[model samples]
Target: MAGGGIDTRVSHRAASYEYKVTRYLIFSCIVGAVGGALFGYDLGVSGGVTSMDDFLVKFFPLVYERKHSHLKETDYCKYDNQILTLFTSSLYFAALVITFAASHLTRKKGRKASIIVGALSFLVGAIINASAQNIAMLIIGRILLGAGIGFGNQAVPLYLSEMSPAKIRGAVNQLFQFTTCAGILVANLINYFTDKVHPHGWRISLGLAALPAILMLIGGIVCPETPNSLVEQGKLEEARRVLKRVRGTDNVEAEFQDLIDASKEAQAVKDPFRNLLKRKYRPQFVIGALCIPAFQQLTGNNSILFYAPVIFQTLGFGSSSSLISSLVSSSALIVGTLVSMALVDRFGRRGFFIEAGSEMIVYMVAVAAVLAKYFGHGEELSIPIAAILVAAIFLFVFAYGRSWGPLGWLVPSELFPLEIRSSAQSVVVCVNMIFTALVAQLFLASLCHLKYGIFLLFACLIVIMCTVVYFFLPETKRVPIEEIYLLFENHWFWKNYVGQRHQDTLAEPEKLGESKPAHA
Candidate 1:
């Protein structure tokens, strides 16, 4: 089952070479990871600004008046306008579309090009948003911001993964996630104070988006291209030089040779996008390109992130206090990310996923139970109950931070071959964006209709996602990017299809039927 007349070249790259933490590697990764702030600032900023009374009154007066209605059924339904939700969801719609172009840019022009473009676009969008007086301008600005995110999301994870040695790849790549959380925290802190300033506070929150864009713009200029990318462009001497520098050694022949061979394999495939559709890649396509990113959004952590201030407002806090409440939750996200960075390499990816998934389920249920018991059609929630609700959600956010929030990006970046990496990353971002857009578009409406049951819906999604990860995703810790093929090739269910359609290799297949059992 391991082969159907297809050659298999298993790599011992990870075992053959070891890497030390080098200054260049750290600098490049930090620069690349700054891309996450562009994404995180928007996530944290949009929700807070939307919940600002002045912002809603100016841009969405219908929802604004409803917020003051004080009607029995208005608690969850106050901000449920479709057009209002568009302010948040519109960014993703634009991101999903632009990511295809970013894919080509990433593969042909290099990852840094896309990151630079993203930062530039975001900087402009921030300027427009800060000055906008109409809803049209705000939406247009969001669309531009989405374009920035599309490019950033497409390039940053792959950049981090390619630049890193296998031993510390998780921590390196997760710098993107950590920076994203950091951006969110900063945005929340800004909003907490800005909300108190009235009419122009939201503008200050919106304009500061330019700061992270500036950071990444500087970073894009500073960071070196990944050795894999250099090799892909046929800059073999440059690739060798970069590889030597990044690895901190002249003894990089083994890795350099592997990169040459992989580049040869990559060149033979005329169109990677078309090649990605081959049967041999089914496992990667289904789980990595499709399921993981989509499911990450479906876990609904962003619902809390995007509407945390709003949810707290409904629980009886003013805009400032609600922003403060979200600040606490965002702080937990940073803590969880740090915990993951410390433990992920040691504990492995799948363990963190399974453990965190279970933890999220428990917290989701706890949140739902509390809301259902004390929050009702005409009832006001007590201080104790609201505190408990926020506490449960804080733990939920922490669980998500460790597992899905970062792993969604990390796992997909791990799944693809270099030849199709850009294409696959594009798909990952598109699917993630589509789901994210849907969630952003629907969450307010769903919250109004489903009430506490909305929490239970996310819990059910967590169950399905955890099951898929258990059955389909293999542990990828410490696996070299060049060698990830073996993980799929030897996987219990994936082995059946991994190499059956690959056309570029001509070695004897591994002994058949030697794959691990399903539960292994």
Candidate 2:
């Protein structure tokens, strides 16, 4: 009788664990990451398009139409440079407003719905940009594109981060950053190949982004809404069903309990945004919504990625050589993102932030010194040394790819509890987009007017970033989302959370004066 009873219990347990991995989750994340690609592609393609005088003349004919009617075609080309600068900068103008709205929209619509909305909006934006007859049309198209990107930017990470197993969360979430680099490489390649053949190649590039948008929309139709969203709607069974598939049965009930607890806390909370200001979560909230993105943009990454070809050209690389270097640089970004994924779970969050931030300071200063010495005023100091300087650009991409690039998203995802994750994510992403726009706008103007002065300014910013990270940042890896609050509530997270085996190297080793294992 005892043997029969044990067998019955085992069979029942196995039966209860039944679940299958669906294709929908994987497909949805890919589709979501594609929106990130469009943002990267558009940013990169504009760099080359901005330099094309003929394309600018054709695209923004209004500027030249009335101002210089009789000038020779060649002379008119020279006079029309002003309009292209304005055209190139229009993207930043649009992104700033759209990102703020994305937070509220995501809160109301849910992740999948917001993504579909963004994709459709992107499709319309691409059509408008492709068919633009005047600068006004172009600006409007840019705004539409910005809206789409804003929605995706906020929605993709939140969905991916939540759905992924915490064990491999960094690896899965890194896809967004990977596709971003891939898009940049694609854009750079298209620009370089079409540079001699088609000045209006930008239209082709802009239209290519629509293909991904369509796929994303289709994917959203097929994928399940996140369990978190389902729960928020009072569909507890539906949430449990989805969780069983994603998380498996080993600890399904326990995991579900945690989810339920988090949901209750979240639902009980009156205003997520206001609650973010509560003393306990406030520091993390500020770090998520402000510090992460600030660290990302202040590293001079935008200055390097967008203006690499220009900087390379100044360093005596032939136009084609500079283009090849951009390809290599983007490839390095992909590789670095992969490396970051490998170490994220191992080294923990704060370690990655501090190490990456400190290293960036070193590289940014070196890049500044190299740019000052090897190239200035559109001239090279010496061809041989300039080649070396051109190669150093890859270092910049690699540094960012490893640290600021992925961590900007990763830190916020890991730092906040389930209740405040979305609110914190929205605020941080909005801050990121705002500063990204500001930095992009200033970077170009600074390059035009300040030359090496931009690099010098970024170098100083990087140093300050390193200081900020070392003093304030907290490490978070392999810890459950709920327990993350313990970091804020407990006085000794480092000592208590970081295991004795890894104590000495931990940032706040003294926190572990008691020296317990990570989980104990």
Give the RMSD in angstroms, all C-alphas superposed, for model 2.
7.9
Which candidate number has the best lDDT?
1
Model 1, which residues run further than 4 Å from truth?
1-23, 478-492, 495-520
Instruction: Count clashes in each candidate, considering only residues at least 3 apart in sequence or on different chains.
Output: 0, 3
The window of 10 residues in a row where model 1 has the poorest summed lDDT is: 506-515
Q: TM-score for all predictions?
A: 0.90, 0.82
In model 2, which regions exceed 4 Å deviation?
1-21, 59-89, 244-254, 313-318, 377-382, 489-520
**Candidate 2 residue lDDT tens string, 1-520:** 1100112232234334433344645765676577668767776766655444345567656633522333322221222244455555556656567775776776666788778887888889888887777778877877787788877787777777667755455676888888887788888888787766665665776667678778777866667777777776678898888887665544466556555655676677677788677665655766676887877888888756776655554444555776777777777787888888777777766666667766766666676787666554434347666556655667767878888888887777767765666677767776787777766656655665666666778878877776666655655565444444445434334333322332222334344222222233
RMSD to the hidden true structure, all candidates: 3.7, 7.9
